[model samples]
Target: MRILFEDSPDYEMVLGDYLERIPISWSRDESFGLLKTRLVAEPETTRDLAEKVMDNREKGGELAGSLLSAIAETSEGQDWMFESLTSGNVRKEASALVMLLNLISSITEPNLDHNLRLLKANAQSVSEDNTHLLLWCLEEACEKERDIFVPLLEEVLRTRGVPAASVYLSRPSLHRERPVSALVLAVEILEEKGLDNGEISLGLIGIYPKNREFVLERLKRWISKGKFPDSHHGMLVAHLKKHDTSPIIALIEELIDSGNRNALYVAANCLEELTQSISEWLGWCEKWESDSNKEPAVIRSLLEILSRLKTYEASGDRIRAIELVQKFASRSNIDYEDSTKHISLGKYSHEGCANTRQENRYTLKRP
Candidate 1:
């Protein structure tokens, strides 16, 4: 049980005070006697007691081994010890649990299955005040006993939402083989519970690339119903741009012709993502320009795209886009001021602008 608390000054200081409160009689047990005594004294406090014991430095390993033997001797002793150690403030309880877990693992040939189950059960009872420690314990359990810890991980995601679940799910080990069932449930919870867009984006990103089809279908359904909020438009577009550009492109085109200013901006941004080159973007402008039914909103979207290209420092692309914009303005008999005002020049270059272009250029041709 080599807990890495020696380097933590706060843990050491807290442990020093915590140990002094425990009666020396508690150290009388031969297995834990020396460890309890040394922990109560000076100089040994600064030393890496856990590491020294594991290394057998000056019989430290023997002392540590005895402590484990004592802990494993009976379920009653283990239960009492755990309850006693954790009956403190949040910091104290966390440190005690961490140390206890390490001690259990350090003993040679220790039976860990039962102890791990106890830890998992304790983890479920943690309150918000001790969530950080609970997450740490869960991660440790994942490393030590993945099969047992996975269900607990799902429970955390289900009850606590993405803020707590992401701490564990984002880990490479879990992220690579993310529990899709849990993630899908989380998405449903997030949607029904109405979490912040940022949190929703985090949840989506955590399960991204793997769940592209699932996400795209959701976005499509949302867009078709005109239920997709502007808050999610950017993140949804970003994720869609990565895996499936067709839906994004179609959505952008539909929104551009819908005559909604906000939706048009969202469409313009999506167009910037889907466009491969200045020539390709110009082609879209030409198509819209030639359309007899193209609305003022479509022209506005084209101007917005041009402004974004300039902001991106795509000088050549900007020039070509600007040329198309000027042609549209001239044909409509609209002056530069109206064009600039309609396009909202200099606004789309920054992040807050609804019409800002994405930097990621896709090579996939539009379907």
Candidate 2:
């Protein structure tokens, strides 16, 4: 383990001794075999065996849990062994550092925080290689072990600002739609450190309604900053419902008139979400549709936005929505051999628009 040697001045000698006795192959599986062998025969060689486990797992194998289980099985495999190795003591020896990371891979057992503190303490004494390895281990551990790791992560976020803060906030592993969750967790950590204020908290909370109070307060503070993007606005609607929709609606109206087609598109999308009445959003939709100079791309995007509104059961403007559907339906008037294949792209079908007369009779009674 690199971290092991980083802490011990005699790590090179220790590594040399291990290499001579341990018959580890360059391949990950072979190295794991060596560790398993050592686990059976040389119980005292826990540190070196642990290093092999780390190396083997990094060599691209699913050996982390198995290796950790083997190491943890014995009394000689001190609970703190992985911590000691990751703390930078094993830095001079690459094998040892890898072993520690591999050992803990995906198992996220308790007591990692106490061990993390030990690693942090040794960080000063360890070499740069060990220090980086230790930091990476800390980050990885923090990701899965959120309970204890959160408080520690907050401290790290407070102490290390900017890029690190952004780094801490973002989890590269997450899908695009899931990044907001990680950002929300990161905001909580930042808030604990007092490093995050209302605006930043609002941005995250707007993305995650569970963070409602923080988001609503923050949004109120920063509402003048300009209209939020569609995702954020949608999140706000969920967070505050229609209670705070008035101001956001005003902003959406301004965005629709901003002259920027992209902004207008997003504004129209927001309008589609805000008012219960589709008629209110239809004026902007009509304006966009009337713009003869508007790019085909903008029109296509607007059409898609209207299509989304048309599908909502709560939309208030059936007449305008039906009109939009008719407009788009006429444009898609290609003759078809099969009626099913002749599906139109408008807001609603002729049958559906006619059916709405009956639907609106009951819908008009909703508050």
Clashes per candidate, residues 3 or more apart or on different chains: 2, 23
Write the residue-wise lDDT of candidate 1 on 15-111 in tens digits: 4443444421232334445554444343333334333333433333223323333333345335433653456544334433544445434434266
What Cα-based lDDT does every candidate model obtain?
A: 0.51, 0.45
Tell me, what's the RMSD of every candidate?
A: 12.2, 12.6
Q: List the pairs of residues colliding in candidate 1.
A: 1-102, 1-106
Error of 1 at 76 (Å): 17
1-367 in candidate 2: lDDT tens per residue? 4224232326434544544443222123445454455444555454454444445334311232233334543445444454544444342233333344444343444545554564454433444433334444455555555565455545554455444444544323322232344456556556566654433434463354344455544443333343444343444455455455666555434434555454444454455565565455565566555544333423554465556655435345554544554454456693222332343334566655655445444323222
Residue 156 deviation, candidate 1, in Å? 3.2
Candidate 2 lowest-lDDT run of ten: 59-68
- Residue 325 lDDT (model 1): 62
TM-score of each: 0.52, 0.41
Residue 359 in candidate 2, Cα distance off native in Å: 15
Cα lDDT for residue 130, candidate 2:
39
